[model samples]
Target chain A: MTTPEPDRLFTPPPLMTSPALTPPGLTPPPPTPPNGVPLPYQAAPPPTTGPSRAPVVALSALAAVFALVAGLFTALYLGERTDRDTIASTRADQERTLANVTGRQEQADATLETNRSRESTLTTQHDLLTQCVEAAKGYFALPPGQTPESSRLFRVMYDVCPQI
Target chain B: MTDHVLSIPSPPAPPRPRSRVAVVLLSLLVVLLLGASVLTIVLFVGAKEEHGLEVQRLDRTSRSLTDAEGRLAETEQTNDTVTDRIATLEAANAELHKCADPAKESIIAARSDDEEALRPAVRRAAENC
Candidate 1:
């Protein structure tokens, strides 16, 4: 058997170069007109951008949060103001009602006092009338068959005697 | 010949982001605040006006009450005076009734006529006639 000699100083084969391939399931679409004119243009994918959509979305979310916070604060402030006004109005109404009630109570008390005074005066007048009736009875108690003139004198005495 | 280096293509620029929604929301908030401020101001002004009217009404009522008080006092005074006058008239009437007894005159005449007067024994029986 003869031993084959090694290929010393042998040059390696050239590297194999491949053409760029689109991703699987992706295809280059036919160019379409943007303004009714046919043009050969490629649409840029959305992901490869200066700012990621996440940052813009975050900024938008922050702005929305700020707006919501401001709106909530404004709403609360307005609600508190409305409550203050309502409380103030209710307090004023209550005060007015109390004043009216107090005034009516005073009027009623005054009326009661006046009526009591009138009643006392009437009671005194009734006593005086009773005394007059008693005196008339005394005159009627005169002896029977007394002359009409004598009876008339006795009646005059009765009318005047009540004063003493 | 110049040697050319291999190059890599960079990604395309993304579309510029818009702030339309934020702008619209800010404008709406501004309008809402303006409307609320106007409403609050109008309500405050109306409340003040109502308070003023209430004060005016209370003042009018107080004045009327004062006038009524004065009238009531005057009436009470007048009533007292009338009561006093009535009492005096009643006393005078009672006195008149007492003194003007109709039978008083007849009683006095009866008493006087019952007492006969003798004139000096008729001048000693008229000097033996």
Candidate 2:
């Protein structure tokens, strides 16, 4: 007995039609048998619907990875910003300390300058006082018979002390 | 009739529930990615600007500290010198007073004597006192 042919009623219809049946500007359909029977072992055309789930899932995973990277970058930036704030605070403190130190140094410098001037005046007075004392000692040591007005010691005393 | 019935394909299988869920999840991930990227860029720029300002402030503070330290050192040195000079002047002044007072007494005692002796004592006292 001959093998029974596939029943046309039960055979599923081809999803695509022939190129002649397709409209212009539209993709032509793959070649199909005139009787609308699919050849055995022929591969089905790819679906025209949207992308499959695998590529979508992969793209979603990639997006998740990018988001994770961005989150990590944000965390790092925040930490660095905090560190910068800390540094800025420290710098401000250092500046205040430096200002105080500079003020103190300036005051000390002024004190030193005043002391130096006083010391110079004191030294000059000390030198003149010493010379006057020496002249007095020499004049008193001279003999009583010597005339005081013509003496070198008396002249020195007069010059150093005009009050005499 | 059978061909007509077969030709009319059954309505496309209803979209899978899981696929819809995946699309929603993908959209949420994209939004998350964009938000995170924008936040990262903003934070990065803010951090960079702060770093620049901090560096400038730190450099200025360091220089000021250095200058202040040097000035303080020089001031201290000058103060020491002045202190030493003051001590010397004080000692010399004490010695001068010591000698002047004694000589003044000697001149006073001589003033009661004869004119020849008294004249030299008067002149000496004038110079010393």
Model 1: per-residue Cα lDDT at residue A120: 56
lDDT of 2 by residue, B1-129 (tens): 122212323456647776778888887778789787888978888898889889888988888898888889888987998899899888887777554544444444454455676566565565655
Clash pairs detected, candidate 1 = none
TM-score for each model: 0.36, 0.65
Per-residue CA lDDT of model 1 for A30-136, tens digit only, reads 33322223343445545554544564465556556655655665565566566556656656665665566557656655665665566556545444444433333
> Evaluated with lDDT, which candidate comes out highest?
2
> Which residue segments of model 2 deviate by more than 4 Å?
A1-51, A145-150, A159-164, B1-21, B101-129
Error of 2 at B69 (Å): 1.4
lDDT of 2 by residue, A14-66 (tens): 44555565788887544444345443443444564644777577768879777
User: For residue A46, what is the lDDT in candidate 2?
Assistant: 53
Whole-model lDDT for model 1 versus the true structure? Answer: 0.49
Cα deviation at A100, candidate 1, in Å, is 3.3
lDDT of each: 0.49, 0.69
The number of the candidate with the highest DockQ is 2
The i-RMS of candidate 2 is 5.5
DockQ category of candidate 1: incorrect
